[model samples]
Target: MRAIFAALLGLTTGMAMAEMKTEKVEYRDGDTVLEGYYAYDDAAYKGEKRPAILIVHDWNGLDGYEERRARELAALGYAAFAVDIYGKGVRPTNNAESGAQAGKYRADIDLFRSRLNAGLEALKARPGVDPARIGAIGYCFGGGGVLELLRSGAAVKAAVTFHGSLATPRPADAANIKAKILIQHASQDPSVPLTQLGDFIKEMGDAKVDYRMIMYNLAVHPFTVPGPQYNEVADKRSWAAMKEFFLENL
Candidate 1:
């Protein structure tokens, strides 16, 4: 009987896993072929459109991490798209390559913005997505990506960044931005120094932007990911904060 019960449990889990649907989506951005993965709850969204969330990847570009995040959002009843910032199926495995790719885009901010806009358009065009209600979340390099989107006056309702840099080479006009912003920062993050954070907060205050900056006292860079750099407590708290922010704004 115990063995039979175990077999039943395994079967149930497998069925649950199978119910999570994922698909590869490709769209044209000018002359470039952009690619990404779309995920959602197949059972819940069968007949109705759902709120959509765009997942922007780090400097590594589109990879397993962002795809998994999309799945998590889908389980929460959202149509989530893991956006591609580095063209179709391109992922950098090492710091050297990642830096090179990131630097190339950073050197020409307009081109970078165009790529992100393309991803947003793709998400908006999806059949089951509520184009008017959209949110975006990004990590590391992608974290900065979402900020750029918000700065560009995209139609996003909410934007969240995890361990993203706060400095923008071209400062945004606060009046142009319409989205409610949530920035999750690691207090001990070496890359984004405390002084820079202070300046960012001051700039936001001066601009009169509606924003919230949460600093995890003990967290370091990449605190949310469950990899080597993850901080379990900070991750939980930040996710809870994200959920609340999305609920209120998105």
Candidate 2:
């Protein structure tokens, strides 16, 4: 079932007006130091506060894909920060390594949520960011990370996940969610089956949270990424949907 956001499909972030200023931001989660990518249009909002968006990377860890998305968000007038979940210099080179790194957090929800919250805290502390008007978006594993942000009851107004993991060990924590959610998923994803989607819908319903889930038929896992699983239609539509969601919520 499509939610009330189907009309937002045509909304684009528009052309870039100025050079985006980007940098590597170093922050921490407890004793673990992390390095994230931060981008913003300094020409548009110099010394002025704006809503910020936190981006979580896929299973392979923070890389060029996530950073490019940060710049896109920056062009859209948001202070975007692409968060690092695997700590500084912990990027994984292949699926095996990425899965191993992501597995550690999956098995430990506390650490997963903490790392996400740490990123949120870092984004909130950045200059010219309005902490109250914050949102988060994640891709694949990172998508699950943003949902964890909701489950952890982080102070964010919006959360979006693209082809993310739907099952959470603590489904009861859904009640703690304080943000509106948008989920972009693949209808034919082998990694995430229909049963999982059903359970997730029920979890959100039981928690009485506002949420929307869009399914792209025939698209597989990680459909948004520009690779074998890439679904151009799904990627563009989902991104447009997110932009509209943030424009309204944040």
Candidate 3:
């Protein structure tokens, strides 16, 4: 009888894992084929409409890390999808290549916004998602992308950025922002220094936008990812802040 009970438990656990599902989604941005990852908890979303979040990936493009983040959002009863910034099979194996690919879009704001829109449209079309309660979150380069999404007056309810660059060529464009913005950053990050953050804050202030910036002391670039620079204290607190913000807004 004990052995039979153990078998039953194993079967139940396997079924549960299967219910928490993920799939690779093939999409497009004007002729460029994009590959993305979509994840959701089948059991939680059954017969119910839930909020959907569009996740933008780091400079490395849409990889395992982004999918894991999507799955985490799914566990919170969100239909999460990670969008591909680069074209299908265009992943960069090294920093030099990644920078070049991400730079092209960053240089041309129109192109970048369109690419993000393509993904947002795809996620919003999902049947299980509540189209009216849509939001977005980004990491690294992706974080910067979502800010641009808000600046372009996208139909997002909320937008969150994690350690993303706050710089843009046209600061006045913040006037067009429609979504509530939250920026979580590492204070000591070399790429996004205090001066840049200050200017971003001033832009939002001048535009009378609803936004907030939270900085973590002693935390540097890429603190949330699994690496030597990861700060457990900062990560835990920042993640809690994001969860709380989304719960209230989305």
| Candidate 2 colliding pairs | none
lDDT of each: 0.86, 0.91, 0.90
Models, CA RMSD each: 4.1, 7.7, 3.6
TM-score of decoy 3: 0.92
Please give, for residues 1-250, the per-residue lDDT of candidate 2 as tens digits. Answer: 2543543432332223456899999999999999999999876666778999999999999999999999999989999999999999999999899999999999999999999999999999998999999999999899889999899989999989999988899999999999999998888788787788889999999999999888888888888888888889888999999999999999
- Segments in model 1 whose C-alpha atoms lie over 4 Å from true places: 1-18
TM-score of each: 0.90, 0.92, 0.92
The residue ranges of model 2 lying beyond 4 angstroms of the native Cα positions read: 1-17
Error of 1 at 153 (Å): 0.7
**lDDT tens readout by residue for model 1, 1-250:** 9999999999898667547789999987798888999998876666787889998888888888899999999888789999888888567889899999888877877888888889999999988888888999999988988888877778999989999977777775555678889999998999898787887887788778899888899899999877888999998898889889989886
Looking at candidate 2, the ten consecutive residues that score lowest on lDDT are 7-16
Residue-by-residue lDDT tens digits, candidate 3, 83-142 = 998888999999999999999999999999999999998898877889888889998899
State the weakest 10-residue window (summed lDDT) of model 1: 168-177
Please give the distance, in angstroms, between residue 58's alpha carbon in candidate 2 and its true position after superposition.
0.6
